[model samples]
Target: MPAAVAELSPDAPAVLLAPLLAQFAAVARLEHVTRAAVELGMPQPTLSRAVARLEQELGVALLAREGRTVRLTRAGRIFLAAVERGLSELERGAEAARAEADPTGGRVAFGFLHTMGSEAVPMLLRGFRADHPGVRFQLVQDYTDSMLQRLREGELDLCLVSPRPDGPELTARRLGEQRLRLVVPVDHRLAGRQRVRLREVAEDAFVTLEPGYGLRRITDALCAEAGFTPRISFEGEESETLRGLVAAGLGVAVLPPATVARPDVAELQLSSPGARREIALTWVTGRPLTPPAEAFRAYVLSVRGQLPLHS
Candidate 1:
C-alpha cells in the first residue's frame, strides 16, 4: 500500500473522509487554496484547517504552498486519481438508487413459473402496463424452488409461484388456483375419458417435470393422497415439453391446462384427490421494495381474482 493509504485507519468511517477528500480535490483542480475555498463556499481558514487535518491523518503533505497558489506533490497527484475514481463510482451508485425509487420510471425484477409464461403472465403484464405505462420490468422464468432462491438472494423483487411455499424469510399471498390436468396421447387407453381418478393411472408410466419444480411436487403429493406413487418414465424441464413427450406416446403427465388444444393429445380433468395448484405472489419478508415494485405488487393483488387461467 502507498504511505498515505497505509496511514488511513481501517476502522475510520468513510463519512468522515468524504468531505475532506472533496475539499482536497477542489484545491488540486484549481491549484489555489484560497480560491478553492471560495469555490466550495467555505471560509478560507476553515478549508485550510480541513486540508491540514487531512494531511495530518495521511502523514503526508499533499500540497506545497507558494504564497497564494498551491501545487500537488507527487503523492498528491496519485491520491487525487484514486479519490476521483471512488467519487465517480459513488455518484453512479447514487444515480442508480435514485432511478430505482422513481415513481414514474423505475424498474422491478420479477420472476414466475415457466408454466405461467405461455398466457397467464403475459396477460398480467399487459394489464399492469396499461395503468402504469412508464414502469419497466425485468422478467425471469424458472421453476418454483429456483425462483424462490433468487427471491431470497435479492435478485428478484417479486415472484409468481405455485404450491404456495412457506418460510419465515418469505411472504406469500394466495392469488388463485390452477386446475391440474392429466395429459395422454390421443390413442392411449384412457384418452377417451373426460374425468378419471388419479389412482386409475397409478400403474401407468408417467412423464413429468423434473424434481424441485413446483408442479412435480404437487404431482407427487396428489398421487400419494390417491394411494400410490406414479411410475416415472421420463422427466422434463418445461411443461409444454412434457406435453409434447406425452403426444409422442412416451408416457402420461400431470400438467397445467393447455392454452390451445392439440389434436395429438387428450386432457382429462381429475375427479379425485383434487388436483389444484394454488398460485401466490411471493417476496422476501421485511425487504423494502422500490416504488415501481410496490406499485406492481399492489396492482397484482388488486386483480388477483381476475388472473387468466385456462380450463
Candidate 2:
C-alpha cells in the first residue's frame, strides 16, 4: 500500500473517515488552518489535528506546509474533486429527505402517455387533488417506453402507461382497459355503421401514431392479424392530431373511446381478438416510493372504477 493510504489501518471502518473528509474539504478550500477552523467554528489545533488524521487515514500527506500558508499535494487535489461531488450528492439527498418528511405537502413526479393527458389524467388528478390539495405533482408526458425508461432512472415515481409494460425490473397494476374505436370522416361510408371488423378496413388508408408508441404497436399488431398491412396515410404524435386528420377525410384511425368527438368524424366500434389497450400504473421494483407517492398509488387503485372505461 502507498504510505499515504497505509497511514490508516486496513481494518479501519470506511465510515470513520467522513468527518475528516469534511475537515479536509474546509481546510483545502481556505488553505489556512486558522481561517478554516474559524469558518468551521472549531479551534485551530482541533482543525489541524483533523487534517493530520485524514492524511494518516489515507496514508499520504494531503498538504505541504510552507511556514504559514499550506498548499494541497497532488493526491489532495484529486481527492478534493471527488469529495466535492460526493458531499454535494449527500447534501442533495439530505434535502430530499427533509422534503419527503414534510407532513403538509410533498412533490410527486408522475408520468403518463400523451393519449391519457386529454381526459384520463386530468380526471384522475382533479379528484386526487381535491383530497390532497396540498400535494403537488410534476407531470411528465411521454410514450410508454420512454416513460418506463424514466421510471427506471428514478425520474418518475410512477407512470400511467398502456399495454401494461412487461419486465422483471418493473411492477405494474392494471387500472382498467380502454377499448379502441375506429374513427372515420362523417361522410365516409363506414361512419354509418355501429361496428365493423378489422378486415373491413383492409382496403382503407389509416392514420396512426409514429413507431415507438404503444398505440402504434397495437395498431400494427391488429393490422397484421387482420391479414393486411395498413396503408398508412399519416403518422403523428398526438391522438387529437390523428382525429383531426380523420375528420378531414385524410384517413381512418383507431383511438381510445374517450377521445374527443368531432362533428366531422364518427367513432365506430372496431372488432378484433383483443380490441383494448390495458392502462396500468407501473413503477420500478425494489425502489422505495415517497410517502405521498405511496398514498397516491393506493388512492388511484381504489378508484379505478371511476376511470373512463367499459364496465
Please provide, for model 1 over 7-42, each residue's C-alpha lDDT reduced to its tens digit, 9 standing for 90 to 100: 556557465677799899999999998899899999
lDDT of 1 at 256: 86
Shift in Å, residue 285, candidate 1 = 1.1
lDDT of 2 by residue, 208-309 (tens): 998889999999999898899999999999888899999888999988874545788998888785778999999989766777788788888989888875
Each model's backbone clash number: 0, 7
The model with the greatest TM-score is: 2
lDDT of 2: 0.85
Q: Model 2, poorest ten-residue lDDT window?
A: 1-10
Worst 10 residues of 1 by lDDT: 1-10
Over the full model, what C-alpha lDDT does candidate 1 score relative to the true structure?
0.87
